[model samples]
Target: MSDTRTPLSRARGLGSAKEGVHHWWMQRVTAIALIPLVVWFAISLVMLSGADYAVARAWIGSPLVMVLLTLTIVVGLYHGQLGLQVVWEDYTDGALRVFMIVFTKFIAVLFGLGAVLAIMRIGFGG
Candidate 1:
């Protein structure tokens, strides 16, 4: 077998990761998903604005609302991670870039888990 890649590509090694398109696509998809979820979240918050703590708790405890809120949290965190990754990649270099990318990912996951736990606690009336 013979390699067909251009000399410049072979030398530079700046070619595709094959995962870039997938990541890009997922970022866009999550962004689109967030539009409706954010709108629903905003409206839900507005409707609950004047309500008491119990009323807000009850609203969050509803199965449908709980699921939507969880979805919103998960998707929003994922989307934010993707965006931050791009920013870090573009603006940083070497160790700092690697550190920032890892740190961002870690923080995003931690926050997402915290959000999930909080939602579950409220939903289960704990």
Candidate 2:
């Protein structure tokens, strides 16, 4: 195949980064994974509403509940990070875009770890 890109375009290295498909698939997968987890969480909250602190803590202390809650936190953060990454990539440019993407990811991870730690501490009666 003949080279179709103009000399200027080639010189500028403007082309597909070859990551679009992977990013798209990950977004879709995370969205699907979040659906059931979020529904379960919403229902659990509704059921727990107006309950005393001990009751709520006991609920979270269940092994199954702890595992599911951890999954929810991790998956939700990852999904959120993926979304903010796309927004940054689309709306920003150059150094600002890079900074926003990295910053968003870092914040997501930090918050995710903190949340998981809190959940574990409560679930384990620490």
Candidate 3:
């Protein structure tokens, strides 16, 4: 306890373990951003139900809808990965933890791409 470590050393706490606050804050920030978007999404989906393919296409075809949808998907996916990263850190066993984190990141990127591509197709292919 009397080692007299530098302030940087004490603040780091994790030493070389890694800085986790950014990941934590990004997760929360994205979540906060998504709450309002998701409410709008829910309403849009409900009202768009029973719409034919063309109608559905037109609904998502507008530039405003397209951009918002893309943003929502991207943020949601990133946040999802961050939240899962924390969960994996807390629950995963030793050797497999790194593997799980990488895999989760890959999956998140894939999902985000899928959502963006889907929206783009709907917006432009019509």
Candidate 4:
């Protein structure tokens, strides 16, 4: 077998882990998905700004609105998790990096579920 890597490359120990492309693609996909969802959400919020509680509740109670809201929450959480994971991976290492990533994921999931539940409660008139 022939060694193709240079001395610095071997010394630095930085090599492709074969997962970077997948991670990059996932980040991009989530970002693209968030664009329209966030735009819709922002516009909806603006339109609902002056509405009363009943009107707001009715808007959220709509099936389409509920579905879109759920999607927005879920995707936004996932996207945030991915970005935070990358930051942790880049800025920290060893146990702290692992812990940060795990903690970030936990918080994201927790908050995401909580938000969705709240949305569901309002949407279903619970």
Candidate 5:
């Protein structure tokens, strides 16, 4: 195909970063991964709703549940961060954009770690 963009348009340097498609693909993949995990988590919550603290702790401490919960935490935060980055990119510019991106990522990582730690503590009876 021939180049259809005007000289001025080309000179503006607005073009694809080539990384966008990868980001988009990852977002979709993570979202898909979360579907079953989310459903399981919700149902588990309902099932455990009226249970005693010891019962809930035992349930969470199971190896399988701990692993699944960790997976859910990691994937959910990653997906959330990706979506937030897109929103920040779309709404901000320049220094503000950079700050927002970094801030969002930092917060995501912080929260992810906190969640994992909490899960581990519960699972390990710590």
Candidate 6:
């Protein structure tokens, strides 16, 4: 008699969850990228504590600051989306899973954009 149980029989969920591992890894890598950025950002804020608004704006208006801020926003948004996805997958299932994941991402994108805009507003005043 044949053993009959194919290798595929042991797997769970739809097809290969190929993107799952990629997403997981990306999230971790992005988080690692943010650590130094956040530290630098914090130190920058502390260093700028004595400066006036114009000086503060000039500091952040520098190309270096803009680039770093952009990187931080991208990494933060991606990390937030990934972290929320895990929570969503754990807490909700079926139709709700799709809804939660998409909704969470939508909200994250909006929040991230808002944060970036706020930073830009700081750097470029009214």
lDDT (CA) per prediction: 0.91, 0.89, 0.85, 0.91, 0.90, 0.81
Instruction: Give a tens-digit lDDT track for model 4, residues 41-92.
Output: 9999899999998898899889999999999999999999999998999999
* Candidate 1 weakest ten by summed lDDT: 12-21
Q: What is the C-alpha RMSD of each candidate to the true structure, in Å?
A: 4.7, 5.0, 2.5, 5.5, 5.2, 4.7
Q: What is the lDDT of candidate 4?
A: 0.91
TM-score of 6: 0.68
Query: Deviation in angstroms for 122 in model 3?
Result: 2.5
TM-score of each: 0.80, 0.79, 0.81, 0.76, 0.76, 0.68
| Candidate 2 ranges beyond 4 A from true positions | 1-20
Name the candidate, 3 or 6, with the larger TM-score value.
3
Off-target runs (Cα >4 Å) in candidate 4 are 1-20, 49-52
Per-residue lDDT of model 2, residues 16-111, tens digit only = 683446777888998999999999999998999988989988888899999999999899999999999989989999999999999999999999
lDDT, candidate 1, 1-126, per-residue tens:
899888977776645773436778899999999999999999988999899988988888889988999999999999999999999999999999999999999999999999888889999978
Q: List runs of model 6 lying over 4 Å from the truth.
A: 1-15, 45-56, 114-126
What are the per-residue Cα lDDT tens digits for candidate 6 across 45-123? Answer: 7999999977877887777898798787778788988998999899989999999999989988888888778778776
- Model 4 TM-score (2 dp): 0.76
lDDT of 2 at 78: 94
Q: Residue by residue across 14-113, what tens digits does model 5's lDDT show? A: 5457343678889999999999999999999899999998898888889999999889989999999999999999999999999999999999899999
